[model samples]
Target: MLELLAPAGSMEAVAAAVQNGADAVYLGYGDFNARRNAKNFSREEFAAAVSYCHVRGAKVYLTLNTLLTDRELPQAAEFAAEASSLGADAVLVQDLGVLRMVRQVAPDLPVHASTQMTIHNLDGVKMAADLGMTRAVLSRELSRDQIEYICQRSPIEIEVFAHGALCMCYSGQCFLSSVIGGRSGNRGLCAQPCRLKYGWEGKADSYPLSLKDLSLAGYLRQLRKMGVTCVKLEGRMKRPEYVAVVTGIFSRAIHEDREPTAEEINQLQAAFSRQGFTQGYYLDQQGPHMFGVREETKEPKELFALARSTYQSGEAQRVPVTFYAMLRPGEPAQVGVKDPEGRVSTAEGAVPEPARTRPLTTEAVENQLARTGGTPYRAERMRVLVEDGLSMPLSALNALRREALDGLTRQREALPSRHMGSYHVGARYENRKEPPVLTLSVRSAQQITDQLLELGPALVYVPLEELAAHPEKAKAPAGTAIGAILPRIAWDREFPQMLDNLRKVRDLGVTDVLVGNLGMVAAAKELGFTLRGDFGLEVYNAQAVKEYKKLGFSSLTLSFELKFPQIRDLSKALDVELITYGRLPLMIMENCIIKNRTGSCNCQNTNTLTDRKGARFPVVNAPGCRNELLNSQTLFLADKAADYQRLGLWAQRLMFTVEDPQTCVQVTRRYLDQEKWSPKEYTRGLYYRDVE
Candidate 1:
């Protein structure tokens, strides 16, 4: 059976979902959740909500799915312990650090890889299972074929977003909110800058970044047949009425094993929608058709009122219960209630008397025990053992039934046992005594010149495709090494070809690979390439750095979102690098924004998006014809060489995205010589100031 996972922002939303037939609910428990802007639950509220859902036969998944700083890991681990004590069915996590902490503090608690982890391929799912995750919520940008390909071979359970708002950028890979403003989506304070309008080549401003909300209510049966464990609905910030409408409809569709009716679809749209729903990603359709902005429309009061009434009645009979009654001539009459979860409760009533004119019948006993109304339980089966001539008052049987049901409810609400261990954030692994060296990452082989390689940089990373195209570039000076960079986003269907490309590069004597996503990690390792974690891995905390090291990464680039103090305090479990120069990437979009606006591949041209403030953010071509939006200003820290060196970094990476070969050479020389120079337009990134 497929689980209908609904989002709950408040107790009202929890009630709305459970009462409307949600199999489970995921909600933010504290400030550590990605939906911190929602009306997240407090400790008291969370406990109450858990009990409420448990008794009603629904699971509660605590959301601690945010990037945690080293300073916040201990507190977040403590909260995970609290959630375990309260009997959370599972926890959804995005940060590897939080995943490590949860495993340490609450070993018995199950962990689900949140969609924000950007798990899209089979290797990613296998890696998640290897890391102890019981399930992985794949990225919403995957097509049905891609999803099916992964699900066919995944070791752990698979979850796909069935209905929800869509993000233009792949989840966890977005930095627009943080770079444009001080708010970070990874930290749960997204300002939603993607919703704003931007222009292309001085064209009319339009919402190229906003995508239509996804709706797969019609595909529940297909998803279930594909072996999906759960189908999640995305709307933690939505109202209780929206939860009721969406959950009820999707639940009905799943239970009926059919698509939703036209009327139900209308009710879904009336409840909430951005223009209309889209199945673009699932159908492998990507273009202007996927773009839409939320338009203000009149609320359908009647639909909302009816939806509200379904949950507000508080009489939803979801859980099934069985009753066993025993009546003897002299002994007390007893009634026992049992739920499907094997929870049993019993009550004894007054003794039965001898037979009267109206004797107690099996049918009569069953009639009284079956009146489980006004509760979340329904009488599914009944067994009565009455003596031949036993007479019992009807009121006595009713009392016994009520007491047993109440006891059963109490039993169901009781917390399940869990184990918790101690956790502590330790100091740095080792104090680095060596000064940091220079490394270069280029978008194409064209960015790599003989002069740049002559600088004797520690490593020069070119794209795997670029190296495959120009395999001769794999040769470098003895002091300078060459590596291949895996694509930031590759679906399961593309892995075989990606592997072939990797093999080609490896055959050319390129022994190093820069991995940005978890899916690429296993593949790169399998090919005998030395793994170097890229910025796309989002190594924010010391624990993640340690996690990457455990995954066989020889080195990793720390997240640009980190402040200098945070970077300084991170554990140097493995060699860590920082981007000292480049136009920092803002968003790695699945949809090609350049082609969406220009109706052709203008990637070779100097394409840029002009924001409302007239800031030009360059759009560069990525693998699979995707687009990467670069930050408006370059990250220039060549003048802060001493500051970075004191932090004990292994290397300072100069990312060359749009720069030409000559410019790349010039920038490498500046960082190599430690010359104090700054571009006319440059930013220190989030290193100097804190991000919200």
Candidate 2:
């Protein structure tokens, strides 16, 4: 059966979702979850909430889905183990390091790949299965066809976001909040900078970044038919009433196999909306219609009050239990209760005596046992074995029913035994004395000038599309190699053409490939090209580096979000690289910001989005007709060469985005000569400063 998964930021939210017909509730255990700002459960509160949900036939999924450093890995692993002991049905995780730690420490606890992992294709889902994830929450940017394609081929269960607030950038890929406000969304402290207004290409200020909330209430049945295991509702930061209202509507739609009524849609908007909802991504109709800012509106007190009254009453008939009773002349009367899962409990009452005035009938005893009012359970069926002329007091039968129900509740709430193992942080690699080599990654072939090549950088990476368009330009000095950089986001439908392109590039003598997303890793390996990991892998700790090494990556570029000290201490399981120059990409968006405003493609030109503070972030075209928003200030670290060299990295990549060929050459020259020159506007990019 398809599951309806709801978000629970607080204990009240847990009850609201469970009572309203959620099959499972995913919540934060502490500060480790993605919604750290939500009123997450305390340790005690988590235990209580788990018991509450379990007894009512709802599963609990703990959220440890965030990036973890080496120092926090052990603690996070221990938390996963604790959650397992507290009966968490599973854990959702983003970081490969955290996934590794959780598997090691709590092998019995199933792990799901969170949406923050940026998994959107069958290959990505298969890779996650290979890594031991039982389910994969696909990227919300996927269209209906893309989701159905993945679902058909995925080895593990597939989950799709049914209704939720849409992030302008893909989940797990945004760095705008961290770069601008020192709050890392990967660390669960997003300031929602995407919700703010900005100007596009010298145009007037407008809310171009904010996107309307996604509502697929009309598509749940279709998704179920497509073999989607679960549909998740996104709103952990919302109120309990919001959880109740939304979960109730979606649950009814799924259970009834029909769309929600007009009144329910009105209730959804009143609960919360960003100028109503959009199915833009689901229908593959993304454009200006998808952009909207949240407007202040009056609260729907009557609707919220009705929802609160329903959940808070705590009388939801969610679980169905069967009653079995036995009465004999000489033996004590006995009653047993069994839940749908086959968990049974029995209780004994006073012995039945010969009736003086009236004899007990099976109907009389069953009538008393069926009074399961004010409970989450309802008596679905009952069987009573009553001997003729046997009498049992009504009070005794009521007591017997209560005791049996209590025992059954205890049995239902019991935690499953899970194995816990030890986790030890691996030792750091010895620092190498050799100076790091330089590599170049350009947006287009035009950025590869002869002057830059004369510097004899170890390797030059050009996008696969760019290389395919200009196969003649796939040339470098004998000492420098040319590699193809795969697109950061590619749907499964594009894989056939992408494979053809990869083969063409491979036939061009390009033996190396740089892959930033997990979905492309298998294809790159299948074609026999050397694999190098990009920053999109989000390798924040040594364990993730080791994991990637195990995944067949010969080299990896560490995440730019890491501080210098954190990067310096990572264990070098394989060759590791860092970005040393050029503008850092803040967001890789599926929606084209330029096309939304201009209704045509002009991404090759110099375009930018100006914020309210006048900081202009460059926008460049990405593969698949998407857009990449580059940081306003370039990350220039030529003067910090010595500091980088001491970290013992294999290479320092100069990402050449939005830079002319001349500028790329100039920047490469400065880094090669170890010149102490500074650009008028440049940033260290979270290297010198810490992010929350």
Candidate 3:
């Protein structure tokens, strides 16, 4: 049977999932994790939770899935070592430095690639296998057939998201959150602007980008039969009641081949819903609606009553169950604990027992909560209660506990008990290294040629916008961008300015020009210019990279969001040199803030946005535009240099910034320099390959 993995934002959620029949639960504990907003487990909480899950025969996977910076290396590595020592089954990772740390400190622990790594094909799967990845969580954008194709060719297990919220952008490849909200999704501070209502700047619809949730309940059987190892549910942001219901539904389907009854499935909608559900990109083709259309749902009175009863008992656990019930005055209730064996022994009376904190009956709880209306389920305390107005029978309360216990027992038994180590820990052989080549980004033909005389990089990169910035430089036509002038320059005499610049760049020592626009490609070919792919183009998959190569570019930069396996696949499949080092550009936006037409943005300049963990950062919109300047994602891979070189990498690029040039250079040296450098603990940004 396939494993049913669930998300847990806290120890309460972990317990709830384990109790409700989740085979395994994935959560974050510290800096390297993806969900910065979730109530991540503290070291003690994490260790205790792991022990609790293990005792109940459930598995715990730590999330170390965020992008990392040089400064965060030590903390990330320490967390990895701590997680391993605590007996975590695996750590879900998204950065290369962190991957290396696991390979050293806890060489025996398994590493699962986080979806932020954006992997999608058989070649990518093979590359991950070569790097010791045990599993690859295929990208959400893949169709079922595409995933199946990869599964057939892959050496490691394949895991896919079976349900939950879907990102409009490619997984881990989006900068919208960070660019617009100041919270980088790559670093787990996602401001879900996608859910916000918006009027299109030029489109027909009022809410152009709002998408629906993905629900493949109708297709669970098909996924299981495809040999997919795990069916993941994606909602750490939801309440435990939501967690319990979803977990219960999927757990039954995957384990018994028993899908929810129509009414039960409708219960999901009643609990909460958005536009509705779609199979998402799993069907291979879709529009923005593949995300789902938003819809409102009302809670059923019966379900609400059930939830009220569960909450009043004070015996509630948070991980796997959500109580949804309405309460009235004078309800009878019992307080008790349910053991792993499915037995519930109600404690004597319904009072707050000092030792066990046994919960009160409905009558007492209602009286206490009367002023508050009712108590919503609190994960931290594992309690829920109806207001002073609710009531229910004692026998009915016992029955509810029994039902909950049964679900928990079954969920706990589904996960594996043994340790699953780092991605490449059990590899049969080691890889050989090859030094990387270099690429230079120049502002003009003069700078290009001058630098080339003494330092000839393998490729030359330039920005389209920059050409227009310096019109008098005699490099390109006035106002025509690099993309537009590339074809018109050299051969077109009317474009004397561009011709001079192109000729000078070639004379200087440049071997190739990186271009993204088709006009530039056409211009380069017409002018007989040497060309290499530029980072401006978002090259995500091997197919895309190959297409660019066929278009005549000699090399390509893979999307910064790609996982190690995806990187390895592109490296092995294409003959062109690939660049792998540098501080990754986590955000690229068409909407410019500094140059915005709007005098000011709608966002409050002094408003502080709080992440899941309640850590707050002050908000600041870029001057003169609706575009916002959010947090930036940092990239570092010094610890995994040998691993990357072995994958046929040619060179790495470091972005030169006014503030971070020295630091970027130091980090680049740490990875590219050949003199016997000792490996220091580091966090792997998006290149993490552990996908199990």
Candidate 4:
């Protein structure tokens, strides 16, 4: 059966889901989940929610899907143990550290890869399978055909977002919120700054970044036919009424073989939608129609009342029970109740009396024992063995039936989960005597002049477009490795030409290629080029690093989101590197900022955006690259070279973005030596502080 997974931000939402026919519901128990801002349940509430869903024949999937630091990893592992003990149907997770801990603590618990993992393609999904994930909630940006491709090649089950609000940036890859407003999406508190107004090159893209809420309800059959095992709704942070309506709609569309009516589609939008709806990256369209911002749309008061009516009065889910009753002229009346699982309990009533005005019939025994309408249980079958002229008071029969049903409920609640104790932490990192190698990344040919090359770095990465357009810029002095940095956003219409551009860069003596996204990895492999993994790949954990290594990454750049301690511990597992200096690219945006705001784009690589705080951030425009939003302040980490080596990590990169040729040389020289230097305006970034 095709699974319709709903979101449950609170206990009320859980009831809303099951009452409306969700096969399973995903929610959070603490701040551990990505939707930490939502009204999540407590540990006690989580257990109750799980039990409540299980009793109703539905499953509860807990979301512990945020990236965790080293300090919080043990706590996350303990929670995993608790989830297993509570019999969670599965856990949706993003961090590879959590994946490792779950395998150790609760080996039997199925792990579903959260979309925060940014698994958009086959290789990304294959990596999930390699790490023991049983299912993957794929990236929302994937087209239907891309989803079909991943599903076909997937070793595990595929879960796709069929509906709800869409994120402007790719999941797990957005650091714009963190750098700009100190709210990291990877840590689960997104400020949602993308919803703000911004313009691009002359096009003036209104709400260019904010996408419309996704609605694929009309395409459920086509998706199921494509072998998509689970269709997930996107909002756990939304209201219970929203969950009830969306879940009920998709559930029927998937299970009842019913197509959504046009009226129902309108109800979906009226209930909660952003400028109507878009099918999203599904349907293979990334045109102007996909963009939308919030609009004024008041929901009908009647619709909310009707939706709440479904779960308020009675048990949200019904369970069937069979009953057996006995009565005799002088013996006590008794009733036995058994659930479908064969758990049985019997309750004794007051002693039967001799017939007075009326004789006791079999119908008399059955009538009192069969009334279970208010409870979770429904009487499916009833058998009564009775002697004529036996009688019992109505109160006695009612009490006996209630007692038996209560006992049966207790039996179901007592069912044990597959429990594994806490997982053990593995090996630790040791300090290295020698300092790690240094690499330099420059955006323009102007920054990689003779003075910078004199520093004699281990490797130098120039933008691929720069290398392809001017081969002279890629030429390095003897013993200094030269490579081309792949563009982060490689879109469809131009991807074929992008590959050709990569090949052109390769032919010009740039053998070492810094590939970021999965498509770049695939392209590098196809062209037989040496692939260097960039930080854009989101390699946040040891497992992800190993997976990329297995995919033939010669060198790996760890995710910038990791704290210093996490970077240290992860480096112990693999010889990884971190960027030590430069203006970190905060966003790789599809829409051109200059074109939107200025009413014209000079197509020049230089542009600046002033935020509400009046801080100016640089915008880099280049061939083959998306609009690059650089951080307002540069990242200065040269003072931490010793600290980097102390973690047993081997490399520190000096990135030169928006810096002039002279500043690049000066920065390179300062870092090459043990010279302490910090730019006038620089940030330590996420290195020292915890993301949350």
| Reference-based TM-score, model 3 | 0.52
lDDT of each: 0.90, 0.91, 0.54, 0.78
Of 3 and 4, the candidate ahead on TM-score is 4
Per-residue lDDT for 280-316 in model 4, tens only?
4677655567777778767767887888988786764
lDDT string for model 1 (428-503, tens) is 5874768888899999888888888888999999999999999889999998999998998998778778989998
Question: What's the lDDT for candidate 3?
Answer: 0.54
| Residue 577 Cα positional deviation in candidate 4, in Å, after optimal superposition | 1.6
Model 1, residue 691: displacement in angstroms?
A: 0.7
Rate residue 152 of model 2 by lDDT: 87
List, residue by residue over 118-195, the lDDT tens digit for candidate 2. Answer: 998899999999999999999999999889888888899998888879999999999999999999999999999999
Q: What lDDT score is found at residue 30 in candidate 2?
A: 72
Q: Which should have the higher TM-score, number 2 or number 4?
A: 2
RMSD of each: 1.3, 1.2, 17.7, 5.0
**lDDT (0-100) at residue 351 of candidate 1?**
91
- Give the CA lDDT, 0 to 100, for residue 137 in model 3: 84
The segments of candidate 4 whose C-alpha lies over 4 angstroms from its true place after superposition are: 199-208, 295-300, 316-372, 377-419, 443-454, 462-475, 484-532, 537-555, 562-571, 589-609, 619-627, 637-648, 658-666, 673-682, 688-690
Error of 1 at 640 (Å): 1.8
Question: 377 in model 2: Cα distance from truth in Å?
Answer: 1.3
